[model samples]
Target: MPAIRPQTLNDVFQQAANQARQKLPELTHNQQVARLYRKSLKVLSSWAIDRDIFNDEATKIRARFDQARGCKPEKAIRLLREAEDEIFAYTHPDPYCNPVMPGGSKFMRNPPLPMDVCFPDGNYPADAPKYEINPDWSKATPENGKAATGYVLVDFGKKNME
Candidate 1:
């Protein structure tokens, strides 16, 4: 049997990008330039780890944008396209993500159990207890297999849980 791979944040991002591309409207020259600038800065951030160094590189990027600020529309479009290509080429293979955020090592490590379990017939029994919070396992019975008390529940999404 083929192994089922869990979807990663990269997969999520790729899907989003695909959708965006499919539905993308034409951008004005200024919007294109702004997008390229933001993308370039993000690429630079991933490449330069040190704050001092990143600041220096970011300043250089700002200067480059400043230099092109008054270009004619035709030239600006060309420059924006080139800048986009450059940013894409320099993008990090594995960009840094906060440990708790998407694409990070600890992301979704411990997902929450379902709010309620369904039997093979796809419905809860009439006697099934409704729970607003988590079951207090301390008061659970082995034979009855039920909790006698409730605890506050904290639920993050399967993709967001840690």
Candidate 2:
């Protein structure tokens, strides 16, 4: 429900990935992304159930990928495909069930952060790769930046891309 639950997604795959460890424990970065994508789809589709509004899974948008059976990036993204129609697809006519899409749900939940550090949490590998950002953009809004503009400004979150 609600496009998909990341916590549920993570738990299911984490366990599955562990089981596959003997078969393929360490998947490449790309593979991990792909595996997450596949498992996410499978779990999402399986739970779709018999809904009234859905147009059927055939004509929906989806992210499709292959599971190379590894960790990190186990499931490599192949082609994005929709496995099912929105359970609340008829929201146009009926107002319920609109929350099945990402950002579609109105309910909110609080997320716990691992470390409240301004330091770069960095990428998955801790030191995956680094890219340069325009120094000017890193500055706080003009109001805040007017206070100071130096010191390798670290934003705990303008949100990390990956």
- Using all chains and alpha carbons, the TM-scores for the candidates as numbered come to 0.53, 0.20
Best by lDDT: 1
Q: lDDT of model 1 at residue 120?
A: 58
Cα lDDT listed for each candidate:
0.69, 0.39
**Candidate achieving the largest TM-score:** 1
Q: What is the clash count of model 1?
A: 0
* Model 2 Cα lDDT, one tens digit per residue, 1-162: 568646777899999889888763776655654554454444445455555322354223231222233324222232222212332332233222334212234322332233323345533455532433232233434533344544434332321111
Model 1: C-alpha RMSD to truth?
Answer: 15.6
Once fitted onto the true fold, the runs of candidate 1 whose alpha carbons sit more than 4 angstroms away are 1-22, 109-162
Instruction: Give the clashing residue pairs of candidate 1, or none.
Output: none
